[model samples]
Target: MNEGDERALKVAVLGCGAVGSQVVRLLTEQRDDLAARVGAPVELVGVAVRRLDAPREVDVPAGLLTTDATELVSRGDVDVVVEVIGGIEPARSLILAALDNGASVVTANKALLAEDGPTLFEAAAKAERDLYYEAAVAGAIPILRPLRESLAGDRVTRVLGIVNGTTNFILDRMDTSGAGFSEALEEAQELGYAEADPTADVEGFDAAAKAAILASLAFHSRVTASDVHREGISEVTAADVASARDMGSVVKLLAICELRPGPDGQDQVAARVHPAMIPRSHPLASVHEAYNAVFVESEAAGQLMFYGPGAGGAPTASAVLGDLVTVARNRLDGTRGAGESAYADRAVQPMGETRTRYHVAIDVDDRAGVLAAVANAFADHDVSIQTVRQEGRGADAQLVVVSHSAPDSALSATVEQLREMDIVREVTSVMRVEGDAE
Candidate 1:
């Protein structure tokens, strides 16, 4: 240490798992480079863990590992805390303590943020400290920073993305190899693309959390995970993939957030995560395997895409390190960086009220009046048909109807009415369509 230089910024790590291990490694390996970038030396003081003897992907120095995370955050001397311990409870409590104790925080906890971000943001603002989570949404793709900083001045209309790598990997396999959902999921698990319990990713909870964060950032509103309408890829069958193929598109689980006009002539926000069919030519359609991509639309920037590896140890760790540098630099400068922006406070419109398009496949009797009854049902519900194609043998025919954009309530009602009618045999599949003209 030089006598003439200011004291180095002390930082701490919470959790030494996959991403955390990589973070520790980078802090040790790239100490000088990070110090140069932040205009001050960034030192790792401690790593909080559940068990000291638990096997780790990377080795932790003997003196740094501790089981009590609460003590580390409230130590009064730490300048920044990097949290990779996901979930609520300890993570949230520790973060609040760190901020209240005058320490900046950089985390990758999407669940805590999506469920309760305003509280944390308010706490950080009260303490005049920065809380940055660049790794929360899309791994190393740099989506949140661009949305929060670069497009801060501009109005963002929409954000459509493939945010979950596990779902994307499963869907990509189903689309390419014509595999069933079970078959594709097994392959994903064997290839380490999915966890032993992949419920969060497959059931759309993970993406829904990310979508909530994206919506909150893009629209400047407070959107929670409950506000998002979620649908898993578990129900996405092989027939759905074939149906998408017939339309020159591919099936993908999408996290979509849009700034839409409300009935009162005010702009409202709608966020959702579901399996959708997007055109093959779309930028996100090409994001195959365990990769992530976000497509942003703004008034000034027009269109922009951020793509990269969405998860795993190294890619996610790199994002955590980037945030650590930014926060550390802000600490040295005696200035605070930007926090959450919920000034607009726009309404998060319900899924039933949101306007969307759908591709409906129906199996009906080949007899006369079947097509007429279906068309009349849609007309009764005020849903206009964009295209209609039918194929099958006598007494076992099918009709594929793609409808123009309409309120979800009306379209759903139309499908329900069709289900009750004698002429309609069964509603085989009803999937949303995105990345196309409405």
Candidate 2:
């Protein structure tokens, strides 16, 4: 090893929870290998935790554990700071301080990045330091780097996939076991796949944050969590899942980011997170249980799929270590990797104006002209139906209609009109259809 490689590079860790514990374990077990890869001995200088007396998963040296996170990052000798403390306030402040103190950062805080990434990027740029967060979006999956580097030259038209494992597990249970939303959620919680509150994952907030990060990277725009249109799987019923199965499809919570034309004919981005029906043949439909998958479509690379364990202590730590090694290498070389690239600065398209397809199921009177009246409702909104199926149960009937690609506003208007019709008893289900040609 060269003289510079002989010197140790110091690392500070914030938060000693699930991901942080696994990260510390990896750093200790693979210290020699990491040193050979980065051309410098990677050192764990300190670990900042909430309490020094708290029980930990890994055997952290008592001397290295400190509660003063602010002071740990502020230390001038620290060369890199690993932050797994999620949320907005302290994580954000510490990251900024680390960059300003001339230390590169590796983080797994998706909410922080999606909420206010520009602030961190600007700090890194001003300090000439690297801010790498590969563990943010999809746990161990190597999706972000590909979007930022491998596919940099190609024009990405769409990125649609499942980003949250908790939500996916619940939805998959509902499909495979024919259980309702509550039953599936109960199972997920029992298996430790979901939290007691599960609000962030079940209600789509987790996926929405990931979607914002994906849109910003794929489109080179500054997309935030507030910009994503989010809907959860809480309202998904067994009837909806059966409806999808009837059409040879399955329901999955999806984060979709696409480049569409704006009112001015310029390309704009639309990012949304919701439960959608995809054909059984689609690669994403096979992602079961707690696994996650992403499908990317570009001008040159027709279709690419990334699948793996989306969340876990060890899986997430793997991504964190990957970024740590890269940043360490850059530090030894006296250089920095690429920073945020928002040069495109494109506008975000409104959800109402976005074009998509819908699957609607209605309970109507089994009488003449009922189908005609329902067809007229769609016509009033200028929405055309692609396929229609009818089933009779003597006094009443059920109608299933799938519409072609149309403005979301128009599809919603048609559903509202059908609900008010005298012959229509109820609109049983309404869901968007994806993974098919428009």
Candidate 3:
């Protein structure tokens, strides 16, 4: 190979769908800028697609498209592999093959990363190659890089945010328009904010994947999707939204990861994705529509917020390109970026042991001793009540109780016991309270 060819970094993209096409566009349109930034030419060597004739959003040059992803990444001349083909099997195998073949990788596969990130990270480490995946967590918001790079020196205590755009859009609609969960979800589908199935986003699988990624980065530990406690927002009713409004709050599906003490007094990781009521004044509560925001709390940094378009073909592609430039530059420099940081390797706390506040609304008999009985149920589980409000009189009576921070298991037991109580007419709504106290 000539000196010019040796200096030029060859990039193989292993997908030609939404994100893949946009990546191709940026690589072609910003070729000059990318070359300058990398201190060398960046070339799109090949694009691996499932179908050659399939229509694409961007025009991939002739002779660059291929159906064989393995062959494309295995080519000796390929210096960088960008894997936009999301999923576990093929994407994982292709990425591993690329790293083994001595090429750095940039991927936007959150599910793969969340499920089996350590495998990819180990592969890259063994090959002495960079594995940059800033696009995996929050799209163009740049949260992963900050957690991996910028905030490396700071001790992050907690990571909380609305990381899923589909669920956020649905919840935002429900909050703003008093739409039921089904109605809001329908509107989201109509607007293209949600998929036809919508199971992944609405059922909290998407956010759980993202939560695992965030927990791994923030705590410098290995966290997987199974370790994350997930709860979908499909059960959120219009009455729940109205209840939140009455309390000066709004409901949002949140990805929360925290570092807390374990039973042995050692630090443990607690990561959960669920719908919760947050004060309107909170940063995450203000995140509306399809936008994403992450609020970070650390020992030295105090508080930091990263916000932007959480997902979209173009926005995600922007992150992929950013990582591409970084990996390409590293290739030219004969250096590698930071691999996975699992030095802490903390234990993942059980969902039952995790601590948080709860808002429980219960319909009860409008007779004497109802308040005492409810308070006793909470006390029986060692759950402390922070505030209580009673509405209506006689048969129309309802008791809304918000609790102080307590173990989730204890709060859950209290709610269960309340359900069995004869004095309790019905458990109207139960939601975890976050951000602020009443």
What is model 1's C-alpha RMSD?
Answer: 1.5
Q: Residue 110 in candidate 3 has what lDDT?
A: 95
Which model, 1 or 2, shows the larger lDDT? 2
lDDT of 3 by residue, 1-438 (tens): 223334688999999888899999999999999988878888899999999999899888779999999998899889999999899989999999999999899999999999999999999999999999989887899999889999999999999989999999999999999899999999999999999999999999999999999999999999999999999999999999999999999999999999989999999999999999998999888899999999999999999999999999999999999999898877877778888999998999999999999999999999999999999999999999998999999899999999999999999999999999999999999999999853
Query: How far is 264's C-alpha from truth in model 1 (Å)?
Result: 0.5
lDDT of model 3 at position 62: 70
- RMSD for each model, in Å, please? 1.5, 1.2, 1.6
For 1-438, candidate 1 gives per-residue lDDT tens digits of: 222256889999999999999999999999999888888777999999999999999888889999989999999999999999999988999999999998999999999999999999999999999999999998988999999999999999999999999999999999999999999999999999999999999999999999999999999999999999999999999999999999999999999999988989899999999999999999999999989999999999999999999999999999999898888877877878898899999998889999999999999988878888899999999999999999886776899999999999999999899899897889999999887889
Error in Å for residue 218 of model 1: 0.7
Residue lDDT tens for model 2, 1-438: 233767799999999999999999999999999998888889999999999999989999999999999999999989999999999989999999999898999999999999999999999999999999999989999999999999999999999989999999998999999999999999999999999999999999999999999999999999999999999999999999988998999999999999999999999999999999999999999999999999999999989999999999999999999999999888888888989999999999999999999999999998889999999999999999999999777566899999999999999999999999999999999999998867
Report how far residue 361 has shifted in candidate 2, in Å.
Answer: 0.7
How high is the lDDT of residue 216 in model 2?
A: 97
Candidate numbers, best lDDT first, in rank order: 2, 1, 3
After TM-score superposition, what is the CA distance of residue 402 in candidate 1 from its true location, in Å?
Answer: 0.5
Q: lDDT per prediction?
A: 0.93, 0.95, 0.93
Q: Could you tell me the lDDT of residue 429 within candidate 3? A: 94
lDDT of 2 at 232: 98
